[model samples]
Target: MSALGAVQPAEAAGGTRAERGDRESLFRPLSAEDGEQLPAEIESLCMNCFQNGVTRLLLTRIPFFKEIIVSSFSCDSCCWSNTEIQSAGRVQEQGVRYRLAVTSRQDMDRQVVKTDCATATIPELDFEIPPFTQRGVLTTVEGIIDRAIAGLEQDQPIRRATDEGVAQKIEEFIGRLRQLKEAQSPFTLVIDDPSGNSFVENPRAPQRDDALVVTRYRRSPQQAAALGLQGEELEEPAEPAEDLHNEVLQFNTNCPECNAPAHTNMKLVQIPHFKEVIIMATNCESCGHRTNEVKSGGAIEPQGTRITLRITDPSDMTRDVLKSETCSVEIPELEFELGMGALGGKFTTLEGLLKDVRDLVERNPFTLGDSSAPDRTQKLQEFIGKLQEIIEGQRTAHFVMDDPAGNSYLQNVFAPEQDPEMQVQHYERTFQQNEDLGLNDMKTEGYEEETGSR
Candidate 1:
């Protein structure tokens, strides 16, 4: 907000997505006018009729903050419902954090927590719940741990063959958490949020002896950079990479599909997140057919790169993903994939990319036309439904992009605090790929540049 936070509507601009500091808001902020009372706890409106509104809401005073309110609303006519947690007090420029010890089951319910841009950790268990990956919620300490467990299971990141030890440790961590929840073990829970909207319930402060530890510190420089608040920008490049980029290869041949004359266009353009790769496009003049493929360029990469993301919520749809021409994308759960030539390199969000796949499969005249077989159309219809399910969060799917050229990325808002599922794995490239990228060449500094094959 504008220094003084205010509860803003969804359409309101300038404020954050989590600001709710109005007088009628759920919570009576610390800076509110003296003796100001809030509106009714429950209310609803007919979004369609406008005149008719119902009272369907639940309001509770959160024990942690003075007069803090949590509310849930539902509409009778449209069946729309939403739960909101309103933060109290003034603008928390530095943010607030909470650390509580969980020694008994009774403490689980009492350890207040707030999160969204929040990261949580259980020190005794060595379990961490990453920030931004989780939906913002006001929950108990137990609820937070439970959510982390669910996230781990839905992600299914552990592989049987690779990182077996890490997988085992994860399992052990989960088991210990269960024990902690049962009050069989004691642990410490830390809730750190940079948004300044979070807090823990602590009655005793500096005045009296207190077990609670509350620390308010300025955001780190790197964190400020990631959050887009402030940071030093990178120095200007000597010259844009594209200016120095050169053509790689070109050839003329009959179109593979139509057997008609065609010219192949090849260029070495740098992908933003990935490395440089040669993009080739062939168009047939006779048949009006086109094909494209991405190949490794320049010196061969020492390792291939794999990027993975789990589609779990609506927020995940907005994640920026880059798939270079050489990248192979797949959704294992749906058994659908695109090889190099089947799709071209581009940058897009998960939502935009999935929509592209749907349009190509369901609306394409070439694929689902009148002459198409009934069985094929039926299968495509089923796949389209699966895609819809993923978008609606009815199902979970893992999206992976494997690029031999190491030129692909699933970008995160906070690069340093990347989620586990959104990862980049570097592995050895295949010998064939090494040859394709021309890594076999030994010529280097001061060596003569040769045009033809040795």
Candidate 2:
């Protein structure tokens, strides 16, 4: 039998009403333009338990989301009923995430959220909420917290491992959480999803509020694994993923510099501690020029990371580095700064990257030998000498990487931070950067840069 009744246009919803004593209500649709002109009927069996039911998928339109299809299904043979959504258009240019601060009760009902591939967390309490492949949520701030409560209540690992005392403390914590919900106390809710499928409500009307923080980032390898993007093939013997990695994919595209067709090389590499990443290299045989790029195979980091290495000896030159395309590399001694797209991202040692930088400067038409600007040429020559010395362990230098997307890394198998020579700091992206990244509705007027100590 059909789980949904009939396809009809959505009208004004009698919005969820709540008394102080009642539980928070579900989100109410506020005057949709038109919804479900036609509903698609399909066969339905619960992917979970193999229960049978007929499904009805209705098409609708959201404000910023454009086309959306909401699917409703209920299994008659089992207790499985769900309403999920599939957006036809995308809102984020990259992996999207959100941080909503719940300070008032009204903020809860003014938003919509999705957690399909998200790892929601409230760091203050060390609570992590995993999306169980359920539909994205269209609810308020209170609803977000309630979902976290539900996950904690049903957490099997904690329940199985904890004794009565620990279990009691957990229950007490949950009670405090409920109290906070009712009290509308302030708490930060972070949703990190690399799929770019999640959404936090924003009405582009009169000025929007700043209680919620929205971000788009490049995912790391480890974060991508949480979304089941990698490591799944390792379980069952799979030749496809392995074979594809070994076989280099090539393309025939015209070079940006030369009119001649360029041969492009692309292959996947699994970084030891990080996730699998694809390296793309393009070479123009006509002009004898080459270009390369590295992309993180995981979910983008929520915050940006800055890595600094003091090269005291040549051995430091061998330290592995993963520089993302969005990363910026700088050498203070040379007064040289290369922004994103300098060489694109690559997995190389510190020495190798520096070599590429010097080579790039050397080849630049403006920076070539004995320039019209003699003083500038002298500085470049001295910088090159110092770089060579550092490579040969004759002089020391400092290497700094500032990445707003936080995908770049300087590999330190040991605790580099403890050595006092290496430093890793994660800072909140500046107001200008957030604007540049298309993170609208941000207000960082008096915002001080907060540094995260590694």
Report lDDT (CA) for all predictions. Answer: 0.60, 0.64
Error of 1 at 253 (Å): 70
Q: On residues 81-127, what C-alpha lDDT tens digit does candidate 2 reach at each position?
A: 77766543333324766777767666566556565666677776777
lDDT by residue (tens digit), candidate 1, 1-454: 1211232322133132233243224443332334443444434454554533443322233332433334455566667654445443333446556677767677777536465567888777667777666555667777777777766655457453577777777777677777887888778888887766676754321012134555555677665655566753443623335444674455776565434567987776675544565667888766566776555555435688888887777888888766676677889998776654234666668887788777666543223333344665566677889988887778899988888877666766565676866766899987866654556575565554454433
Model 1 CA lDDT for position 31: 28
Candidate 2 ranges beyond 4 A from true positions: 1-38, 47-51, 77-79, 89-93, 131-135, 154-162, 203-208, 223-454
TM-score of each: 0.36, 0.42
Q: Return the lDDT, model 2, position 387.
A: 75
| Candidate 1 deviant stretches above 4 angstroms | 1-91, 155-169, 203-209, 231-454
* Residue pairs that clash (backbone atoms under 3 angstroms), model 1: 7-21, 30-89, 95-196, 274-407, 275-407
Q: Model 1 compared with the native: what TM-score?
A: 0.36
Candidate 1 global Cα RMSD: 26.3
Score candidate 2 by lDDT.
0.64
